[model samples]
Target: MIPHLWNDLEGTFFPESALDYMPEDRLREVQLQRLKAVTALAYDRVPLFRERMTAKGAKPADVRRLEDVRRLPFMVKNDLRDTYPYGLFAVPMSEVVRLHASSGTTGKPIVVGYTAQDMDVWKQAIMRSLYSAGFRRADVVQNMYGYGLFTGGLGLHGGLEGIGATVIPISGGNSERQIMVMKDFGVTAVCSTPSYFIHLIEVAQKMGLDFKRDLKVRRGVFGAEPWTDHMRQYIEAASGIKAYDIYGLSEIIGPGVGNECEYQDGPHIFEDHFLVEIVDPATLEPVPDGQEGELVITTLSKQAMPVIRYRTRDITAIDIRPCRCGRTIRRIRRISRRSDDMFIIRGVNVFPTQIETALLKTEASLPHYQIVLTRKSGLDQMEVRVEVTGDMLRDSVGEMEQLQKRFARSIEQITGLHTTVTLVQPGSIPRSAGKAKRLLDTRNEA
Candidate 1:
């Protein structure tokens, strides 16, 4: 693989090539320099950072080494909310070229801006992600990730284009048209949420389209949702392609934050663009490398909306080493689950992704389901409402009951918690345009 000019510059700055080969002191020295630069920039440019640092009695000059970064106040999502809109943008509006906002399901959307250079950095980071996933110049990428405000579609689209691939910007939804384009364009690669990909597989089968013979896709870059190894195997088996995991969030820079290589071991992070740190979610103290914690990011190269020590709320670990693919950048494992997404159900920590993984393993005739948590009689009751398609029904009440029992067992096996399973008719659950809402908590009494 040919390294981009930016990658070459990154090597000079950090000697990432030596991460696995160099001494610990050397790596610390490089990180200390970068940390100081970021701290100084945040102190001088961003008002929120300046105020927080001042209140914490932190000065840019104080951050003389990597350890000093711990003295700086950590930034969180709420800080962006406190500032609102573009108050957190470091550079003036004149340099801002593009803006992307959060889906805002919780409250007011946190906005992120990009300058021309920032966009270039984003493109490079995403390109590295795609390259790691075995994308080449000859590959025809069909990006099914949503476009517009959501960064997945456009981010991957730009990176694929940057790599000189034929990018079919096929946003998301329109299952019929998506398959049609895949066949007509001879698309070799696909990018989308793992659930949406599974839904498309079923659609193709129902439409009498042969995934192996008709569709030319050989690889899938699945992201925008938490998935599992079992789900990955199922996707690969159903689609006759290798399914690689990609990771990103709009707050830190969209879908190309990190990506799994062809080896399918772990997603390598572009450390040159964004500095990653894993910290205890509650204590905010750095965890030892190779341990799971909340991922915190610092935008080292961004201009318009440079964020320092921004807490991502994502739970994952990092390996500060080069991969067999020859990329010297650090690699981050696929996110286990977001800290906020973890819910305590009767003293058991349950993740919705775990339930989704269990459901996918079963021969359940449904691609859609919702995990609803409600308080009843002073205790939390969990219900999984799944949509049953025609394939699973097949005029057999015996089979339906067996399947429901199997699903309940599967959930128990994965989560160690009992959940009521409700198999509804097809098309019962509503479809969403962005970030599908699969989990609902109605515990608070009105």
Candidate 2:
């Protein structure tokens, strides 16, 4: 179900090699035209944008080019929260067909309403992502990401259907059932969080299932959590499938925002649908191309709920040049860290994902660990409590000490911060149904 509107503009506004050969000035012109149309819509329809523009003593017409977007006020998550339920909705209730809400970890769930056309746009983006990942009509897609209010499962399902693939909507959990379905139905592809995929591999081994020989899966799209190249190699080695990294958030759209192709260089952003900008987190000014900073997005062609200059705390860089796969759309590097999630440990910025990468490379039997941050004697400290598995226990006391020292040194190398490594029994850390929250900051308690 490709959008008819997209097809109409395919050769004119969006060319196959636009990013590759299109001059920057020409691309900017197209973006400016779209920005003007969206701004006009915001001024005439959405009260939130109208009030925001008015408060700035600016009118929608004042935004005539891409540069003018900087003058427009930035939209933050708090704005959506203040509006609540549907206050920020641009279209009337009658036109809306679906509503999706954020996980609400920060506060109230930010609700977004979508019309039929908006849903089509979402499907098209997801389909584009899947196609970029090498999925085809005959492939059997096993969706392991959770379904429902969370966007992973349903969003990918829509895409698989769009691509004419046999979609097995096996939402997360029930690893045994997932394996059974895969074996019985000959599923060819799978999608889920990287952690869950690792867990499933462990379960498969325990049940005497050979991942490479038994499963028909040829590719796996892993996202919803940050992963490193080392983790990608591990997943590929375990599942006998080419692993691709996908990037998205419910705030803008679902998992189809960007995806890595067979080249596995980086996840290409669907720039024709969504415009991405990398800005200095503190100044909100655009950084030079390829510089790491916060990612800001604007929905260029959305009708139901168009988000403009929405700040995504995720930190990454953008490459506007053509990819090795010959796609002209800009590609975004895997997110290095989220600005909101960065912990200040003794004046150093620490990202939990980096620590996780370090841990995975340690080859320690510890698959589960928790990072607890506390202040003692007016100083900050990080305690990494890791559960020792059978592999680590096979070593003697001296080997265990060496493992601990090695981990501490690795942590220092990656995060540039000293960490206290505590070995614990397996199954000690709390489990989570959704994304795991590994960090516990008790600094306020001090």
Candidate 3:
């Protein structure tokens, strides 16, 4: 039996050498070919996609080059909502062997399906990402991502198992037990949201457990929310683990679109399976390489649900230069924010990440924070909720008030938007074992 690691070129034969090290010209040619194929598949198999392509007067033949993808209409979350349960599925429901869904906090959950072939591709992608993050078949990985409905849990679990890693599918929550199991099992790697990992550090410390002595963890895979580089540095220092970012969305596949290698640079995308494009969110035109824009993806190999020109709304840029690790596949900068996660406050568009960046720079501020958007009269108001350390809370009330003013000023200077800053005692903010809820918009409410 062949091992599934990417670097084990002698053992793994699934992902051909071409996907990673193919010349740029040939890579483009492969993308062009797959783009046409997926476009045709979506047009033929899914009615929602067919109507969308028809409305744009775009046929599969129109997508002959990498640049021609602009002709296809964009797929958004609402389109899946309109389709309901399995409306956008390319294959019949019977053919779909697996199903996954989004949180649906705003409305009906956006669901996705996978056939046997799709499952194989999904599994391979995850395994490749895990290898990219420096995990080996010998490593014991504690999968702390949520299990059901959410894709992070099962997505990481199957991939870890495929690579022959000792996977502890602990499945999110249970901070104390998480530390205990990680210690007793001698976990060497962990996969979870970056915030949850920080919470673990706090709980472990409160319980008088030290990662440097009590735990064997040395690496982590963090995703499901946009975190800043400061948070990465803090996680690395607190837990003594080399943290890596993994990117994916439920609309396309899940948790396997791209990942950071040992280099800790931008994530190398699995372009052979996913055709990626960066486009202006406002104009919907392709953005030049190295320019920040919204990410758009088309799944070339998926059978049950092939999405063409799906607008991901993620904010990042693509780097086409060959990686130092020798992979020629293009990579995307870590996602800083998403369109759904953005909100307008008094004419200023604010992202939670921007607030996070400001908070990280402010002294006496903990990593825990949230953004709230409320409608005051006819205007939108912004509020930043942050937690401070116990020592900061113990300071004089006047000093604490001064800290709030200074923090608000820093945010304004960074984001060019004034905000109401609210400080809480240590551990006051509710923590999450899954994706952190960073923003709450109530602009439409009375």
Question: How close is every model to the real structure, measured as TM-score?
Answer: 0.90, 0.91, 0.92
By TM-score, how accurate is candidate 2? 0.91
Q: What TM-score does model 3 achieve against the real structure? A: 0.92
Q: For model 1, what is the error of residue 209's alpha carbon versus the real structure, in angstroms, after optimal superposition?
A: 0.9
Candidate 3: RMSD over Cα atoms? 3.0
CA lDDT of every candidate: 0.79, 0.79, 0.84
- After superposition on all C-alphas, the RMSD of every candidate to the true structure, in Å, is 4.2, 4.5, 3.0
Which structure among the candidates has the greatest lDDT? Answer: 3
Residue range with the least summed lDDT across 10 consecutive positions in model 1: 9-18
After superposition, candidate 3 runs with Cα above 4 Å error: 1-18, 375-379
lDDT of 2 by residue, 125-208 (tens): 887777667777778889988888888888899888987789988898887887888889999988999878877777788789
What lDDT score goes with residue 236 in model 2? 84
lDDT of 3 at 6: 44
Candidate 3: clashing pairs of residues: none
- In candidate 3, position 52 carries an lDDT of 77
Q: Model 1, 1-446: lDDT tens per residue?
A: 22332323123332222233334455456666777776777788988889888898878998765666678788888887777899888888898999988778789988889999988878877776776676777789899998889888889988888877899998998998999999999999999898788888988998999999999999888888777777787788888999989988787888877888666877877665667889998889999998999888877777787788888888888876656655556788777578788888899988877887788778633368889899988989999998887667767789889989989999999998898999987667776744567788899856
Better model by lDDT, 2 or 3? 3
